[model samples]
Each structure stands twice: as C-alpha cells, then as structure tokens.
Target: MNLKLEPGTLDDAAHLAELRALAMRPSLERVGRFDAERARQRLLQNFTAEYTRLIKQDGLLAGFLVLRPQDKDLLLDHFYLHPDFQQRGLGSATMELVLAEADTLGKIIHVGALRDSDANRFYLRHGFVLREVAEFDNYYLRYPQHVPLRGV
Candidate 1:
C-alpha cells in the first residue's frame, strides 16, 4: 500500500466532491451537502494552491486528505476514506503525512473533529489532545507531543 499527497487539479474536483459527500453523509444526516461543497470551493478560491492527497492500495483512492494553512496552524480541512479503507491503517498513514508537513513548516496542527465521531478517538490515539469540546464539535491539537518530525 502506498499513500501520496499532492496538489489536486480541476480534474480531481468531481471525484473529490464525491468523496467528500460519501464521507460526510453519515455525520451530516440533517445537514446539507452544500456545506462541504462550499468549503471546498472557498478553499480553491482563496489559496493559489490546493493540497489534495490519496491513499492508494493497488491503484485506488482508498482514502483522501486535504489541508489549508492559516497563521501558524495547518488546519486539516477535510479527510475521507471509503468504507473499505477504514480501519486498515490507511487513514492513519495519510494523516502522518499531513502532520509531517505541518511540522516541517513549524506549524501546530489543529483539527476540528466532527461533533460525534470516532475521529476524536483516532486523533487521541495519534497524540492529539482535546483542547475543547463544543456543542457543535470538538477541537484537537497535536504538537510537541507528536508533532511531525521531518519525513522521508
């Protein structure tokens, strides 16, 4: 299995959108899909570059990650893995890549875990601490504790 993160192109928009929709629905039952749609759009609009990645095992996008930088924080804007990709370590592997990039830039990584998700647990296992829990969701940070060291 190999994972890669690279700039996403216009051609990836549709697949990326579909991935977001599939990954978000379980959490966005009552919410509209447009939320993720708008966020993705805004991301492309503001940044001259968009970082999109895929976790591939035998040439399929098993999982995906996206990020946008702000101030000193590399906000993990999006993450998704097809159900088949879940629990196979691909998500975790993809995240290690994301965190490593943030570390090289000396940025603290901040991610808002979905309001109710196993994502919180996953983040915790990965050396993140719960900074705050909101009615809407929870925030997590991984720094000094497990901040990415330079990667290969």
Candidate 2:
C-alpha cells in the first residue's frame, strides 16, 4: 500500500482532533455517547505530538496513531482512521509495525477501545487480550511473543 508515517507536531493538533472526532463518531454514536466538542477536546487533552505519527498512503493523510512508552509497556493510544480508509488492511498493517517494534523491545502493549466498538474484535484478532472493562472502555494487553501466535 506504500504506507508512510510522518512525525506529528503540535501544529497538527487541531487537524488531528478533527480527524479523531470524525473517525470516532460512528462508534461513539453506537454507544450513545457521541459528543462532537467533547471528542475534539479529549484528543487535545492527551495529544502528545512526540509520541504520535500521521499515517500517509501515497502521500495523503490516511490516519494517525500514538504509541506512548511507559514504565512497563507501550500504550496504543489514539489510533483513528478516516472513514474512507477503513476496512482496507491499513489499520492491521500499522498494528503489525507497532507490534514488531514492541517485540524488539520485549515489552507488552496496552490499549483501550470504546466499549462495544468494532475495535474490540480488531484488537483481539491482533493478539491483544482483555485486561479490564471500564464503563466507557475495554482495556487490552498484547504481550511480546517471540513465536508467532496462531490466528493472530
């Protein structure tokens, strides 16, 4: 797919926030929690340009992701794709890259998806195991495995 990543900057915050809101609308609406302003504010609240990258396909913005390093594991935060780009293997490709990086560091990756979101199945299919279920989200942890997991 010729996927590429560009380092994100604080200047991109507003744009990223817009993208996040658009990408998350369906899931949030499905869970009866869709709030336009809140969605943008939430991304701005935790946006760390240093830990984020803009995904590009053929030199166009496809989506974005944040991989924050923590004391015990990497956090897979803010992975959102444009509606036009979903269900085309880009998300899986991005995860494979992130997982490979985590494997090299021998660290687990933690992620939380909106409750009842399609992301739940996506994470599970990528080897993430459920760790917790909060009122608004479902937390998952993917351990670094030297050997490939079947069906992962």
Candidate 3:
C-alpha cells in the first residue's frame, strides 16, 4: 500500500481531529461517549506536532499517531486511522514499526485503548500487557524485546 509516516505540523491538527472522530466513532458509540465537538477539542488540547506523525498511503493522508517521550518509556497516544483504512493491516503495520523503534531504544511503550473497543484485542495481539482498566480506557504496556516480531 506504500504506507509512509510523515512529520505532523500544527496546521494538521484540524485534519487529525476529524480523522480521530471518524476512527473512534464506533468504539466511542459503544460506550455512549461519542461527542463530535468534544473529540475535536480533546485532540486540539493535546496535539503536539513534535511527537505526532501523519500516516499516508500512496501519498494520501490515511491516519495519524503520537508517541510522546516519558521519563522511562514512551506514551503511544491518539492513534487513529480513517475508517476506510481500518481492518486492512495498516494499523498492525504501523504498530509493528513503532514497536521495533521502541525495542531498539530499549524502552517500554504505553498505550490505552477505549473500553469495549477492538483496539483492546489489537493491542493484546501485539504483545501489550494490560496494566490497568480505568473508567473509560484500558491501559497497556509493552516492554522492550531485542528480538523482532514476525507477521505483525
């Protein structure tokens, strides 16, 4: 699919917000928390161009993800793919790429999936272990492994 990740810019925040809404709608709806305006606001409030990356497929914007550095690990946040891009292996491929980078740095990666979302299964399948389940999200952590994974 010629997937690529480009550095994000402040101007991309609005587009990323829309993408986030589209990607999280199904999961958010399942938990009665789908609010369009709120979603946009949240993305804007936390958007960090320095850490965000826009995902493109064959040169078209397809999704975005942010990996923020923590004291001893990395926080994987706001990972969203356009609805059309989901279930097509793009997300898994993206995760694998990030996981490889984390392993290379010998740092743990933390991620949170919304409750009742398919993301939970996706993260688990990728070797992320559950660390906690909050009211609205399930937190996970993947420790560094020197060996690379196959068939992600």
Question: Top model by TM-score, which number?
Answer: 3
Candidate number with the higher lDDT (1 or 2)? 2
lDDT of 3: 0.92
Residue-level lDDT of model 3, residues 51-127, one tens digit each, is: 99999988989899999998999999779999988889999998889998999989999999998999999999999
Where is model 3 more than 4 Å wrong at Cα? Answer: 147-152
Residue 51 lDDT in model 1? 60
Q: Which stretches of candidate 1 lie over 4 Å from their true place?
A: 30-49, 144-152
lDDT of 1: 0.70
After superposition of all CA atoms, the RMSD between model 2 and the true structure is: 3.8
Q: Is candidate 1 or candidate 3 better by TM-score?
A: 3
Ranking by lDDT: 2, 3, 1
Residue pairs of candidate 2 with colliding backbone atoms: none
lDDT of 1 by residue, 37-139 (tens): 6644544454333566655767777756667776767777667787777888888887777777766677778888776677888888888888998976789
Clashing pairs in 1: none
lDDT for model 2, on a 0 to 1 scale? Answer: 0.93
Which segments of model 2 are wrong by more than 4 Å?
A: 147-152
Q: Cα-based RMSD of the predictions, in order? A: 4.1, 3.8, 3.5
Q: How many steric overlaps are in each model, in order?
A: 0, 0, 0
